[model samples]
Target: MILTAPVSMFAMLMTYSSNGSSSRPWVTPLVLFSLPLLFASLALRRAIPALKRSPQGSGDRSAAAVALCLGGLVYALALGPALDNVGVL
Candidate 1:
C-alpha cells in the first residue's frame, strides 16, 4: 500500500512527461516501462497481501483489488502512446 501508491503516481507522471521535448526523449517512457514491470507489479503486490489478510467482500480487500486492476488497466492503456512518443511502437 505505502510503496505502490507513490510508484503508480511516478509512473503516470513519467508517462505524461514523455509528451514534452527532452534531449533524450526515450528516457521518461523507458523509465515508465522498466524491466520487471515495477509500476503495475507493485500494485499487484499490494493487492495480494490485502487479499490474504482481509476477509472476502470486505472493503479493504475490495479497494485493494480495484486499485490493482485499475492501475494495471491505466498502465496498459498508457503504454501505446508512451511507446509511440518515442517511436518504439
Candidate 2:
C-alpha cells in the first residue's frame, strides 16, 4: 500500500478541508487498510530473502527497497496521530 496509503490520506485531507471540518472519521479505515500491506511486506522479506539485506549485498530486491520503507514510515506517521486522537494510543 505504498501508493494506496498516502493517496487515501490525501483524499481524506482534501475532503475534510473542503468541508471545513476538524474531525475525520474517514482516517480510521486507512489504518485497517494498511494491514494487507504490512503482511505483504513481511511475506516479501521471507520469500525474497534479499530484501532484508544490507548495503553490502550484491543482489538487491529493487522493487521493494524504497516502497516498503517509505510506506511504513508514512503509515506510522499518519496512524500514530489518528490513534492518539481516538484515545487508542
lDDT of each: 0.68, 0.61
**Residue 60 local lDDT, model 1:** 94
Q: What lDDT does candidate 1 reach at residue 69?
A: 83
Worst 10 residues of 1 by lDDT: 27-36
Cα lDDT tens digits for candidate 2, 50-76: 566645444456655655675666567
Cα lDDT of model 1 by residue, 1-89, tens digit: 34445665565565555565545554455554564356567888788899889998799999998978877886776577677767888
Identify the candidate with maximal TM-score.
Answer: 1
Query: How far does residue 89 in candidate 2 sit from its true spot (Å)?
Result: 2.8
Model 1 / residue 18 / CA error / Å = 17
Off by over 4 Å in 1: 1-24, 28-41, 85-89
Q: Quote the positional error of residue 56 for candidate 1 in Å.
A: 1.6
